[model samples]
Target: MLKIEGLNVYSDNKKILENINLEFEYGKLYLIFGASGSGKTTLAKAILNDESLKKEGKIFLDNIDITNEKTENTSNIYFILFRILLK
Candidate 1:
C-alpha cells in the first residue's frame, strides 16, 4: 500500500499543495484529475521525489518512508502521464 500524509509542496516560497493526504492500495487503479494549474503535476512530482520542489510531510510505500527516496531505487513503482494534443 502507498500512503501520503500531510503532504505539502512549495515552489519558490509559493505554496502549490497544502496539507494533502492520499492512499493507494495494492492491485488497485486510481486516477487524479483537475483543472489546469491545480497542482496535479506538482503532486506527481512530489510523489516521485522531485528535488527541484520543496516538500514537507511523509510518503510511504508499504510502510516504508519514501519521501526522500530516489526514483531509481523504487523500480517497481511507475508513474504515467497522458497529454492530449488538439489540432
Candidate 2:
C-alpha cells in the first residue's frame, strides 16, 4: 500500500502542490488528470525523489515513510512520466 499525506511541492518559491493526500492499495489503481501547468509533472517528480525537484511530503510504501531521503533506483521520474504520457 502507498500513502501520501500533506504533500506539498514547491520550486523557486512557487507552490506547485498543496495538502495532497492519497492512498494506493493493492489491486487498486488511480490516475492523475489535469491540464497543462496543473502540477501533474511536478507531483510525479516529487514522488520519484528527483534530485533537481524539491518537495515536502510524507510518502509511505507498505507503511514505511521515506521522506526527504535518497530513493532507490525504482524511483525513476523519467520512466514514470514516459509511461503516463504513452498511455
Candidate 3:
C-alpha cells in the first residue's frame, strides 16, 4: 500500500498544495485529474521526492517511510503526464 499523510508543498514560500492525504492499495489503478495549475504535477513531484520544492509530509510505501528517500530509490512508483486537447 502507498500512503500520504498531511502532504504540503510550497514554492518560493507560496503554498502549492495543502494538507493532502491519500492512499493507494496494491493492484488498483488510480487517476488524478484537475484543471491546469491545480497542483497535480506538484503532487507527483512530491511523491517522487523533488528537492526543488519545500515539502512537509510523510510518504509511505508498503508501510515503509519514503518521504525523504531519493527519487531513484522509489522506482516502484510511476507517474505519467499527458494532456488531452480537444478540437
Candidate 4:
C-alpha cells in the first residue's frame, strides 16, 4: 500500500496541499482529478519528490518512509498526465 500522512505543500509562500492524507492500494487503479491549478499535478510531483515545491509529510511505500529521501528505483507508482488542445 502507498500511504501519505499529514501532507502539506507550499509554493511561492502560498499553500497548495494542506494536511492531506491518502492511501493507494496495490493492483488497483486510482485517479487524482481536479480543476485547473488545483494541485493535482503538484500532488503527484510531491509523491515523486519533484524539485518544484516544498512539502512536509511522510510518504510510505508498504509502510516504509520515502519522504525527501532518494529512492533507488521507485517505478512502481507511476503517473500519466493528458492534455487536450482547443482551437
Candidate 5:
C-alpha cells in the first residue's frame, strides 16, 4: 500500500500542490488523470523520487515513510512501471 498525506510540492519556492492526499493499494489498477499543468507529471516524479522533482510531503509504502529514501528504495516501483510499458 502507498499513502500520501497533506502533500505540498513546490518548485523554485512556488507552490505546485496543496493539501494533496492519495492512497494506492496492491492488485489495484490506478490511473492518474488531470488537465494539462495540473501537476500530474510532478506527482509521478515525486513518487519516483526524481532528482528534478522536489517534494514537500510524506510518502509511505506499507506504513513506512519513504520520503527522502535513496533512489534504490524506489526500484520496485520503476521496475514494474518499465515492465508494464515494455510489454
Candidate 6:
C-alpha cells in the first residue's frame, strides 16, 4: 500500500496542495485526473520527489517510509502513467 500524510506544496509563497492525505492499495491501477492547473502534476511531481517544488509530507510505499527517499530508490514498486492525446 502507498500512503501520503500531511502533504503540502508551496510555490512562490502560494499554497498548491495543502494537507493532502491519500492512500493507494497494492495491485491496483490508479489514475489522477483534474482540470487545468488543479495541482495534479504538482502532486505527481511531489510523489516522484522532484526538487523544484518545496513540499512537506510523508510518503509510504508498502508501509515503508519513503518521505525523504529519492526517486532512484526503487524496491519493486512502480508507476505506469498513460497520457492519451486527443487529436
Candidate that scores best on TM-score:
3
Error (Å) of candidate 1 at residue 62 is 0.4
List candidate 2 segments past 4 Å from native: 74-87
Clashing residue pairs in candidate 4 are none
What is the per-residue lDDT of model 5 for residues 18-78, given as tens digits with 9 covering 90 to 100? Answer: 8789987766667889899999988876777777656787988778888777777686855
Candidate 4 lDDT, 1-87, residue by residue in tens: 778999998888688999989987766667889899998988877887875678898888778787775423343434221111111
lDDT of 3 by residue, 29-67 (tens): 678899999999999888888888888989897788989
TM-score for predicted model 1 compared with the true structure: 0.83
Model 3 has an lDDT value of 0.80
| Better-scoring candidate (TM-score), 1 or 6 | 1
**TM values, all candidates:** 0.83, 0.76, 0.84, 0.77, 0.79, 0.77
Task: Give the better candidate number (5 or 6) by lDDT.
Answer: 5
Give the clashing pairs for model 3: none
lDDT string, candidate 6, 51-73, tens digits: 77788888887688877677665
Global lDDT scores for all candidate models: 0.80, 0.72, 0.80, 0.73, 0.77, 0.74
**Model 4 TM-score (2 dp):** 0.77
What lDDT score goes with residue 15 in model 2? Answer: 83
Against the true structure, candidate 6 reaches a TM-score of 0.77
On TM-score, who's better, 2 or 6? Answer: 6
Model 1: residues >4 Å from true position, as ranges? Answer: 79-87
Candidate 5 positional error at 39, Å = 0.5
The true-structure Cα RMSD of candidate 4 reads: 6.9
User: lDDT tens digits, residues 1-87, model 2?
Assistant: 667899988888788899899886655457889999998988877877767766776977667776665756437533563455455
Which portions of model 5 show Cα errors greater than 4 Å?
78-87
